[model samples]
Target chain A: MTRRSISLLGVLAASWWIAAPTGWTHRLDECLQAMRVNVATDRLTLDLDLTPGASVAGQVLALLDLDADGEISATESVDYARRLLRDVAVTLDGRGLSLHVVSADASPLAHLKSGDGRLRIRAHAGWDALGTGTHVLDLTNRHLPSISVYLVNATKPADPALLLGRQVRNPHQSEYRLEFTITRQDATDPSPP
Target chain B: MAVWLWASLLGVVPVLRAAESAAVRVTQAADAFVRTLNESQRRGVQFEFNDAAQRTRWSNLPVSMAKRAGLRLGDLTAEQRAAAMNLLRAALSERGYEKILGIVQSDEVLRRQGNSTVPFGQDEFFISFMGKPSVSAPWMLQFGGHHLALNLTMAGDQGVLTPSLIAVQPAMFEWNGKTVRPMGRETDKALALVQSLDATQRKAAVLAFEMRDLALGPGHDGETIAPEGVQVATFSAAQRQLLLELVAEWSGIIHDAAAQRKLKEIESKLDQTWFAWSGPLEAGKAYFRVQGPTLIIEYAPQRLGGDVTMHIHSMVRDPTNDYGKQFLP
Candidate 1:
C-alpha cells in the first residue's frame, strides 16, 4: 500500500479503537493470569497481583469460598476478589488520576459445617468514571496458606472469560491477587487528579 | 441568544417574586402561631425544656439518644403541657397538627398491643427550634418520636420539608379484634400508585435489588445520590396524579402557602424522579422502603413481643437541602 494510504488506514483503525470498550476485559484477564498464591492450609491462602498503571485505590482482596466448610469447600473454589476500592495515586503517561470505588460487594464469611468442605462468597465491583483509562486490581492476604486462588478475566471460548484458579506458591506468601482493567479514553472525561 | 435568554429570565422573575412573597406569608403565619403561646407554653417550646439548663444545645447531625432523651415535654405540669400542645397547634397547620396527634396516639396503639406499659412518655419525643421565630431569619421546627421525625425549615420566608420519613410498625394490628390502622392508609395509598404503573414504567422505577431501608440513614448527611433508573415523566396521567398525592401528603404537613410552594417544586421534578419498594405489600407483615430523587421515605414493622408486631420506624430525607444546609453559610 502507498504510504498515504497506509497512514489513512492507521487513522481509521485508531478512530475505531477510540470508540471501543477500552479493552478493560483484556487488562482484567492479564492481571488474573499473572495472579500468584501460596496455599499452606486447606482453609486459607494468600494472593499477589500487580497494581496497574491507572487504577482505583485501596482495592483489597476478599476470599470467596463455597460449601461453608472450615476449609476451601468443594462446592466452589476459593479466590481473591477486589474489596474496599478507593481513589489512589496512579502514574499514567506521566500524569496522575484520582481513583474511586463506585460500587462493591463481598463474600459471606465461611463457616465449618459438619466435616465437609464448602465455599461461600459474593463478588461485586462498580467504578465511577475517573478520566477513563487503565486501572489495576491488587490482592493481598496473609492468613491460611495453601488456600489461595487468583481470578482473571476468562478468555477461553465456551468458558466464562472470568475464572478463579489457585495461585502458584511463593516464599514471600502474603496471599493476594491484583487485577486490572483498561478504560479507553472517552469525551466528557472526568477531571484529573 | 443572550437576549432571548435574558427575556426568558425576565419572564420568570414575576413567578419567582410570587414564590418569595408566599414564603414570607407562611413564615409570618408560623411566627404568629408561636407568638400566641403563653409564658409557660413558651418555656416548654425551648429545646431540652425539661432540663435544668433551659437553653437548647446544638446536637450532632443524626441526633443521639443523649440529646433526644434529654428533652421531655411530659416534665411540665399538666397545664404547661396543655399550653405546649396549644403552641404546637398554632405553629403547624390543622393537618400537620393531626399528623402529630396521630403519631402520638400510635403510642397508645402500641400499648394496646402490649408493646409497652409506659405508654407514650415525654422522653419519647424530641423537639428543637432552629431559628428565632422572626419572619426573616432562617429557622426550623423539628419534632421526632420513636417511628417519626418531622423537620420544617424556612428560608427567605420559604418553608421546605420533604422525604418526610413516617413509618408505623405492627402496620396491621387487631385492637379489640378490630383492625386498627394508625398509618396504614398512607402506606397503602403509596403502594397503590406503584402497582398501577405499566410494565415499562415499573421497570424504570424498580432500580435496586430488594428494597430494604432508606439509603439515607441517620448520620449519613449530604450523601443523597441523584435519582436514577426511572423518571416520573414515564408514568401515565393517572399514575402521575397518584404520585402527586403522595408528595402532597408530605408537603401538606406545612401550612397552606408553603405547602403550595413545595407542591409546585415537586411537580416540576416529577419527570426526573423514581419510586422503589421492598418486601411484600400485604398487611400484617414486616416490609418497607421508598426511594426517589430529592426524597426518601422508609417504613418497617417490628414485633415488640407477645406474638404481636407492634412497632414502626420511618424517616424522610432531602438530598439537596436536608437539615437547612441550604440556608446555612
Candidate 2:
C-alpha cells in the first residue's frame, strides 16, 4: 500500500498500541491480534499480524528460527506454533477450556524496513461440539509478551457484543480480558454447531 | 491513618529545604546537561509534569511495548554521554549509579543470549525530564528502560524516589571480570530476613499462595494494599535493624543525601512496617513484600519460558506520594 493508502486509515502521524497501560506505543512494532468465533465449525481463528520496525525484526526472526539458523525449519515452526497455545486462554462461560490447535503455520517475516507490513503468522484453531445459543465467551490472551494490548475482536452468530478489561496482571506484562456473548440469530430454532 | 501514611511518605516535606540546599549541586548538573543539547534535542528531553500520560509512560518493557522519550544514550556522542552520566551522578548515589549500569550490562547479556531478535542492548533505555528544574519549584527526573526505572521527584530540598522498578532478565551473568547478579543483594538480604523469622513470626508472615507479580506497577500510581505479614513490632531489635537495612537498599538508589532523607522518614515509623512472603521458602521462585505507612516494595520471581526463577521483577512505590503528589496539591 502507498503512503496515501496508509493515510486513508484515518490515523494521523503514527499510531499507538491501544493495549498499553499508558496507551503509548508505536504502531509499526505492534502485532494485531483478532479472534473470530465460528458457529459454522465450532472453531475460532486467531490471527496475529506483525510489521516490526527494523530494530525489532530480529525478535520475530528468533521466534521463527528457534535454532538461530538463517532458514526456518518445519520443527521450529511447530515449536513456535506450540508457544501460541500456551499464551492464549479461551473459555466458555466462566469455565476455562483447553483450545486444541486444528492447524499451526507461519510465513517468514519480511524485511525490517519493508513498509508492506505483511502478515507474520496466521493460526486456524477449532473447538468441536460447541453448542449454539446466547452463551458467554471470555477470552484471556497472553500470546505476545512484547504486545501491550491484544486488540481482541469477537464475532460469532453475529458480531457479538464485547466488553474488555486490561491490566498489567502477570509479572510486568499486560493481559487483556475480553468478555462477549454470542447468540445464535435463529434462537427460536434450536441448533447444534 | 492518612496522617501516618503522609507522614511516612512526605516525611521529607519538613526536610525539603535541607535537601534542596545540598541539591543545589543536582540542579546545577541538570542545567549543565541541558546546555549540551541543541534546540531540537531540548524539545525531545522535556515534558510538562501534568501530561499524566507522559509522566506515567515508563516500563521494564522493550521499545515495542514501552514508549520512551528524550535523547537515547545509544545515539549520544562520548561527550554527551559523559554529560548525561554526570547529571545522573548528581541524582543517584555513587553505588546507585553503578546499579543502573549493572542493570544495563545485564540487558547486553540478554541480547547475546538471543532469545528474540528484538533489540535488548544497554542503549535501549531512554531519559526524559518532567518540568523544568528549579530549586524551590517541583520537578522530576524520569529515567528507565528494560528491567529498570528511576523516578526522582524534587520539592524544596526533599525528594521521593519511590514508584521505581529495578529488575533484570538473566538476573545472573558474568560482567567484566566477576560474575554479576544485579538483583543479588535484594534477593539475598530478603531471604536472610525471612529465614531469621522465628516459628511464630513465620506463621504470620508467610502467605498461602505465591505472589506472581507486583501489585503496584506502572499506571498503578496512588493505590494501596492492606498490610498482611509479620508486623515490625513482632521483631527483635537486631531483626528490626536487618529490616531497616533492606529498606535502605531500595531507598539508597538515590544520591546519598536524598536516600538518607527518605530512609530517616521511613525509620521514624519503623514499628508500623510489615514483612510478608509467598511461594516456597526455598531461595528460588519466591515472592516477598515490605509495607509500611508510607512505603511499599515487592520482589517477584517470574516463570518466563522454562526457567522459573531465572527472571525477576521488583518495584518500590510510595502509595501516598507517587510522582511527588505529596509535594503537590
Candidate 3:
C-alpha cells in the first residue's frame, strides 16, 4: 500500500490490531465504544469496537438488523457502519477530514444478544504528507451518547516520522484532542509548502 | 541461534531443588541470570516494578511486527544465554520448560520457511525482569518472542502465570528427529471436551459463529466479558474432570507449587467456570474459551496461510490480577 492511497488502512490495521486495547469496562445496560487512533505521515486511522451490554443489545440490534431478519448480512453490516460513522467528526489542524470505511465486521446476532459480541470497524482519512511542525487533531463521537460510554487513545505512531504528543479527552471521552509533531527527518520529502 | 543451541545442549540446569519455595527458586535463578549479564545488558534487562509499559510489552507476533523490550537472547554469550534459560526452568515446570523450547523451535521452523516478511527464530526471543529479585516481594519475569509470551509474576510464595500468550505458527514440526507440537495438548483437550458434550450440552456449549481471532488477546488488559457457554456446575463427574484437565494445560505451565495452587483455586470456582466452543470439533478448526471469575483462556486458529491448523494463537488472563496488579497492593 502507498502513502497516498486509502489502502493504508488495511496495512495499518494488520500492524496495529494487536496493540488496540479495550481498557474500558462494559456496563450492564449501555454501549461501550472503544476507539484506537493511529497516526501516520499521510493519514490517520481509527479502529472502533462497539459492544452493547445485554440490557441494551436489543436497542443496538434494532438499529443494526434494519430489515428485522434476525441476522446481520454483509450489506447490512456495512450500512450500519456507515450510519454509525455519521455521528463521528474528525478535524485536522482546523480543517475537516473526510472519513471512509476500510472494513466492518459484525458479530453474529446471537453473540450480540449474549452481550459479548464486538462490532469492529476500521476507518481512515488521508491527507497530504505532514510537514515539519506540530498539528492538532480533534475527534468526537456523538453516537448513542444517552447510553454510551467512550474509551479512546492514539497508538504510538507507527511511522518514525510522526511523533505523538499529549492526548486530551473529555470526561466522557466522547471528545478527543491529540497533538503530534512531524519530525525534521521528513522535511526533505516533497510536499505542499 | 547459538543461544538456543547452548540452552538446549546444557538442558537449562535447575537452579534450586523442589525443597525450596517456587518463588525462592525463581528469585535465585533470576539473580544468577543477572549476574551473568554485563553492565550494559544488565541495564537492558532490569526495570522498575511499577514500569507498566515494560511489564505489558509483549506479543505473539514476530519482532518486526511487534517490537519487544528486553535483552535479546541472540545478543548474549553461551553462558549468559544458558543462565537465562535456567531462570525460566526455575520458574516453570519441567514440562513447562519443554513447551517453551517447543514454541521457540516452531519459530525456527517458520524462519526456515523463508516465506514470512517478518523475521522469526530462536534468536528473536527476549528475557527481562521488572524489579530486583526478592522472594519476599513482588517482581515479574518476562520472556517471549514470536508465538510465545510468558509473563510470570512472583510475590512471596505466590506465582501468577496469567496474561501469557502461548501460540505456534507451525503447530507441528520436527525436532531432534521427533515430531513436536507445542500446543498439542491444548488443542486435543479442548476438542475432546467439546466432542464429549451431549446434544443438549452442545447447544449450551457451542457458539453459532466462527471465532476468527482471540476475544481477549494481547493488549486487552482490563477488559473482561460476561461468562458464556456451559458452566461447569452442570457437568457430570467425568466431564468435570475433563474440564479441569483441559484448564491445566494453561495453569500447569508454572512451577509445580504454583500450578497446584492455581488449579485448586480454579477447582473451587467450578460452578462459575464456563467452557464455550466455536467452529467444528475437528482439530485446528475450532475456537474455545474456558472462562471463570479468575481465569480466561481462549484458543483461536488463524485463517491466514493455506492451512489454519498450522497457525494458532491462544491467550490466558486472570481478570482480577493481570500483570499481578493485585499483588502490588
Candidate 4:
C-alpha cells in the first residue's frame, strides 16, 4: 500500500481512538520487548513487537513533521515509521527477496502514545521463499534492537527437521545472517548448534 | 587480594592450583557435575568449543520465546540437581548463590499466581558448558532462565563475570512466607549513591536521555559505550569507597577469592568509573547506569501494562572481557 493510505490509517486512529500521556519521559519506566521472525515453508513472517524503540517517538515526530508546524498529525507520525519497513531486508539464499507490506496498524502506535502505557507497536512484513531444495533466510533489523531491547527468533515451525541458526552483526551493523541448509529427502540435516 | 599477589601467583602455576582457590574448587565441582549426567544428557549439555551459534544463543527472554541449549534443571534427577546446586555454590559466593536462587524462586511465585500462560518454575532454569573444565584452560559456565543469564568466564587463576543479565519481574513479591526482592542491593545502594550527590554532582550524574533498557546488552557483544554521569574521581574518599562497595554488590557475585580479584581491578581504576541515573530517584520507578574502564551495570524497571512498578531488567558487563575471552584460542 501507498504511504498516503498508511498515514490515513494513523489519522483515523488518533481521531477515532483515545490518546494517553506520552513523551521521552516514558523512558523512566522499565521497557523490555522482542521482535520475532517465524519461518514458514513458502514465506517468512516477520514481527516487531514488545515495545516501540525508546527513540521511536522522537524519530517519528522528526520525520513526519514536514510542514514545520511543530506538530505531527498522528497519521503522518505512524506512516513515517511504516515507510521505514521498506528498508527491512529479507533475503533468500544470500539474494535479496522482494517484500510485500502485508499489514500495518497504528493501534499500537496510538496506544503507545496514550492508551495503556505498554508502549507497544506490532507490525508484520512478509516475502516468498518457498522451494523444494535448501534455502538460507536472512534479514536486517532496523527499528527494534537499535532503538531498544529486541530478541530475534528465526525458526521453522512446520518442518521440525529444518534447523535455523543466526549470525549477528558487526559493531556498527544490525543484520541477522541466517544460514539455512537444505538436503535431499534421503539425506539428513546438519546438527543444531 | 592485590595485583602483586596475583602477579606472584602467576609466577607459580602449581601453587595457584594446589592452594584450593575458587577456580580449582569450581573446576572440581564442575567435573563432578559432568560425571553425573549419564550418557544422552551429556550430549545435550556439552557443545563443541567452536560452536559459535550455540555459545551466543542465550537470552533473558521467556523460555517459550527464547529457547536455550543445555540440560535444564527440570530434566535432572534428584542427585543430579544436588550436583548442579553444588557447582553453583563453588562458582558463586554465598550472597551470589542466594541472588540466583531468589531470582529463580520469583518465577515460581509467578507460576502460582497464574499470570503466565506458558511454563515457569524454579526447575525451569538450565545449565550449560562450553569447552572442557580445567583449572588452567579457559571455560565458561552459563546458567539462566526467565530473569537470569549468568556468563562466568575463567582463565587460569583469573576470573570475569560479565555480559551477564541479573533482572527480575515483580520487583517485590511474597514467596515462601517471606517478602522477597531479588535486586534489592542494586536498587537500594544505587539510590543512596544518587542521593549522596549534591546539586552540581547531580547535574553531571543525571542523564539527559532516559535509558529504557541497557545500552549494552545481549547481542550487543563487542559494542563500545562512552562513559556518562559522575566520575568516581570527583567524589570524596568516603564516597569513592561507597562506590566500590556498590560495585562489589554486583562483581562479588562470583566466588569469594575470584570476586576479590575482580574488585582489585575496579579499585585500581576508581577515577574512571562513572555512575549515571535517569528518572526520579524515588523508589518505585527509576533507571541507573554504572560504567567504568572495566565494568558496566544497569538497572531499569519493566513497564508491563500495569502502572505498578514491579518488573525490573538489569545487566552487568565487562567491556574488555566477557565470556572468558582470554581463554579462547
The DockQ values of the predictions, listed in order, are 0.02, 0.03, 0.03, 0.03
- Candidate 2 residue A71 C-alpha distance from true site, Å: 32
- Stretches of candidate 2 exceeding 4 Å from the true structure: A1-193, B1-18
| DockQ agreement of candidate 1 with the native complex | 0.02
TM-score of 2: 0.62
Model 3 chain B: ten consecutive residues of lowest lDDT: B11-20
The sequence of per-residue lDDT tens digits that candidate 4 reaches over residues A17-47 is 3332221123423224444455555555554
2 versus 3: better lDDT goes to:
3
Stretches off by above 4 angstroms in model 1 are: A1-193, B1-66, B69-71, B111-119, B162-164, B170-180, B203-208, B226-229, B281-293, B301-311
Which structure is stronger by TM-score: 2 or 4?
4
Worst 10 residues of 1 chain A by lDDT: A24-33
**Number of the candidate with higher DockQ, 1 or 2:** 2
- What TM-score does model 4 achieve against the real structure? 0.64
- Give the interface-residue alpha carbon RMSD of model 1: 23.8
Q: Model 2 Cα displacement at A175 (Å)?
A: 20
* 1 against 4, candidate with superior DockQ: 4
Q: In angstroms, how far off is B33's CA in candidate 4?
A: 1.4
Q: Give the per-residue lDDT digits (tens) of candidate 4, residues B143-235.
A: 998778888877777777787888776567787689988778777777788888889889988755445555555665764444567888889
Docking class of 2: incorrect
